[model samples]
Target chain A: MEQTTIRFTLNDRPITHAAMPYRTLLEVLRDDLGLTGSKEGCGTGDCGACTLLLDGKPVTSCLVLAAEADGRKVTTVEGLAKDGKLTPVQVAFIRYGGLQCGICTSGFIVAAHALLESNKTPSEADVRAAIGGNLCRCTGYDKIVRAILAAAYDEGELVDESASMPVMEKPLFTEGPM
Target chain B: MRSFKYYAATSWEDAVAMLSKNAAAQVIAGGSDLLGWIKDDLNGPGAPRADLLIDIRTIPNTSYVKFDAAGGLKLGALTPLVTVAESADVLKNYPGLAKSALSPASPAIRNVGSIAGNLMQRPRCWYLRGKDFACYKKGGDFCFAVTGENQYHAILEGELCYIVHPSDTAPALIALNASAKVVGPGGAKDVALDKFFIGPRTNVLKETVLEHNELLAEISVPAPAANWKSAFIKVTQRDVYDFAVVSVAVAGQIEGGVWKDGRVVLGGVAPTPYRATAAEDALKGQKIDEKSARNAGDLTLVKARPMSQNAYKVDIAKNLIARAVLSLASA
Candidate 1:
């Protein structure tokens, strides 16, 4: 069997990996690349633990073959935090207590990141629909929804305020929308 | 996973050639189901290995859905589940089909998994999906689902195989009377959705009419009639990506509040998508009032021979058909 050599961009860096024909992207991410953020809760696509972004679209990495990802851009939770800074959604997750055991955190964060990227002002229902696939055993999803909403508000403000204030470290303006 | 030869098809021609060369080869676009089969060792012990896997996700045209001059819908086999669910054209013309596509696996899965893969998904029978007892669906001597833990087993079409067809989109397509275009070594051919399924009696080893190395290229559905009204209703334990305990998809023309030329199909209760001709007949020339809908739903389950543990499915099936009918009636 000839190994399929796949070259793709991961975490804003180009990388090449050799894998068997049927090897899933989850295997390539966790086994070959040692990026354990994407977990495989269920080998089938039911569980959201293996969620990642392929070309800016959220998809179950466990279902996507690594060979299919050749020359395509792949984004994992590791890619969300740029320049050693937590993504807005991640910060909100920590601040709002979005998770408990954190087994499903990476997948949730990935889903949330996708939501915030597309929609700046996502309603609670929108947030719910975005992360509907992710199941959390401990938190009961209240904090997760709050975190996503808060992140959306923060993202909306950041986009608006960042234009005025050059190089401001803190994103949240306390005096803005409550 | 056992070692298997692999080929990444750079083009559709290359993919067809690869499949033509190896009869034992399996096409892997999204590894969603195939990976689980390998990880669980669902294939029988000492089974003939699949020595070749052709990756078709790289084929550009195979991943797009196009509108035709005939006002029909064309779905490339590799079109992702999310695309099918969210396509405006699909939602407008085939809401039932789109809703089935949106049955909600994890967001990530919907994003990458193909609609063709969903219809081609292996049975979800725990016995079949699990490594435990080799059920009859897997060419075993006895069906473990028949007498043991048969809660999720099929209610109808259980004589030959107790396995339920896993695709949520399949029942909707069956209701729409869709056709699948198959491309293989022999060339292209179209098959009706109903005739596409092969029962266990025909070949215990195969699930669909697709021959070895035959690739499902496209699925085409006719445009909805001017008076067409349709709905897909699924009863599941959860709101998310769970398979329906029982589901119904109905499409028909409702004129002056009377259903005519209707097609009703049930899912999750049979080996193939169960078409309720009796129910269709009952509603064909009748107005879809609550009384008539309930009566028609009663006819839907007339032929249902549910197993002892799956008797609840009969009631659920009835309610699903009723609900789908009422929804379509209101539309």
Candidate 2:
């Protein structure tokens, strides 16, 4: 049960942590490094909610040991944007209603980003195959697939107005005594 | 998961030495299969714990897919399944291998699952996998699948245990006449893929013939003949990301549009990848037609002894064998 120091690049920054040998990359990222973008729907590899880029390829971080990422580059969902500007996939998700409830949003964005980076013009089948590992319960995947296709075809300009509705000012439980 | 000491082996010799010295240690390359077993606690509470894990993924020269005139097609033990499925040489020469590699699990799992790890994966029998049941595979007195749910149990070769080998690529490898290069403290040795798998009668505790101290170094597949055609067909409950209920792989040389010689291997049917030698013999001099393909299918399943609930698998296996052979014949 000894802890070992592992040095790896995370979110474009170098990080070193003393972690147990059995600690998964998902655990180290969420617990140790405070990068909780990647969610663990299933600790096993069945659910791809823990998907992240390991040296540019998407893999379930929950199944990957932290030590395996030593000296390697890992990119989580938080690393998708730069300088406060969202990536095309992220913007398209907002413009196309790619998510609901938002539990599996980060994984979908990361996976779609990796796919678009490799394939500029992914067909509907290609997009489906790319995100085949990721599972989303609420959105039913239609909006998510369309969002990715929109991003691939640079059609983010056709924004869905309901996706960015303004928040109300008043709180629902105003001054109610408990 | 239980804690274990981890060592990143830099060379093949060091990895083998580590395994040889520690009998309870296990090698982790890709770790897709081992981690799942560890999480599920398949090793019983009283069983010996895995004290050491030799991480061999860092070792150089152990992750390449090379093809040469002397070696034919060599896949390093650590080569990823996706790499094997996507390799141009593998796709062109050994389409059955490509199909098998691509058939298992999903894209993400294939991205990290190693070829050796796939071959070494344990059976997916729920009775053996779950902690509640004590099947014969876990050293119990009886196998629950014999009279239990028995739907997914083996039908062809279920003497003591009915656990089917869960690997998709293994059948294709066997049909292609591949050999595994194993290294241990003694030295290196080559084992045929057909003989690599050990049945429950041979050793009820393990799957492959790999000793605890040995490491599968590489898998080398013989080059197909000039007119060789190959195909793999798998029937699964779900279209994607599910294990095969019945799978068949066919590889043979077709001369003048007639079948000459070939190997037909069935997966998800028995303890090992079941090679249909009788079916192969049936197709030796026959033309690749519907009648001949159906005859090969019938001959393949002639000896299948189906369980109470798994009688349907026999028919499924036969149909898959026919479809696989017919596809190869027309290729």
Candidate 3:
């Protein structure tokens, strides 16, 4: 198969690269871009180590083709720190003991960030729903959920119980670079 | 995975044209199933590595779901399982369909998997999907599931092949009397959901009745009856990403406190989605009480011939049928 050039915003900077058509998004990010925070626990979509933000929504990068990420903004764990300051989710992860081996931390943070960006104040159930895709074998999920909750509370937008909620609109899924 | 020539279709017409022109071409939409098959090197019996791939994701108008004014649902073939599970109209009128799509697989798989791809996915039999076994599902002359670890094998129709339909949404759709619109080089045509599968004796190479060049265009679901209630129950070893041991989809209308028009379907027990006609007959014209439901469940499993390790599936199917029927009765 002929390789195709893919253009996307990685972390905060725009990147353009040529890759094989069948390579996974996980492989491209870790190999071509040298961003290895996204681990490959399972080549299939079962393990969420390869989770990343494509256009600000969390998805399993392993299942997605690299060619599918064309013209999209891709975020990885390397992008979480700004000006040497840890992002709020990252800080909460440290303070709340959300890491053990730290392998799953990147994917969990990405998943939590995507969840909180749309839902300012999500309930425990909502947090669980959001991060259900990300699995952590070392640390039980209690601390992870707690860390996300702490971040949400510091952000100071509590869930309003009386208001009716609407389903958030999702981003359009497009084919990635092949 | 073997390297293949990749062509991204800007439109459905282009995809159909490419498929018609190349016999070795495979349609890839989500790759939730295809990639696994390729990486595992288990491409079904007589099926080789796809030499050419037609990426169906770029096809216009193939990723949306809409409802028409005539009380029918039109689902484009590439609509994601997550979207189908979360659709308002789908949840309202066809909750069973939503439940089936949402039941198994991780949230990420649901997000990436397309309904059409799931329907076209190869069998989940360990020998078929596994990389180690070279059985009849992988072009071998003998089926290993007959003597190998037959736990997940079929119980009802274990012919030369012991595959269970891998689509989490197919049984529920069949229960709702859905039809598929397939477009090929010969043009578009529709096929009923029940008649879609080809068994071991029929065609071992293909799962569905679709022609080589045919691409599923849309899935059309007929209107439900006025007093209908439906439910889908799947039983598997794990709550996530596992194929069903036995599943049940029940849709029925209750009129005058008696079950009227109804359809009962079973999954994971046959090559294709199996209808429980005897069970449906037992409930028709009768009030769906606990006794009748149990009887119906029993009737559904009367002829089950489980393989060496899957005999437990019969009881599981019976229990699931009763549970599904009772839920419908209560609703």
The best candidate by lDDT is 2
Q: For each candidate in the order shown, give its overall lDDT on alpha carbons.
A: 0.80, 0.85, 0.81
Alpha-carbon runs more than 4 Å astray in model 1: A156-178, B10-13, B45-49
Identify the candidate with maximal TM-score: 2
Q: How far off is residue B31 in model 3, in Å?
A: 0.8
lDDT of 3 by residue, B1-331 (tens): 5566678898777888888888778889978888777767656445567878788888788888787547688888999888899899899999999899886576667777888887888887777777766777577788888888988878887688888776768889988989999888777889998888777778776788887778888999888768988899998886455788888998889887688978999989888888899998999899878899999999988888988888999899998999999898777
Give one digit per residue, the lDDT tens place, for model 1 in A1-178.
6677999999789998898866788898999999999998876666688889999988878767787788899999999887666777887777667899998999999999998898888887889888988878899888788778878886543332322334434534244322
Clashing pairs in 2: none
Deviation of model 1 at B172, angstroms: 0.9
lDDT of 2 by residue, B20-62 (tens): 8897888898887788778777664222357788998989888
Return the lDDT, model 3, position B225.
66
> Which 10-residue window in model 2 chain B sums to the lowest lDDT?
B42-51
Query: Cα deviation in Å at residue A39, candidate 1?
Result: 2.6
Better of 1 and 3 by DockQ: 1
By TM-score, the candidates rank as: 2, 1, 3
Task: Tell me, by DockQ, which candidate is best.
Answer: 2
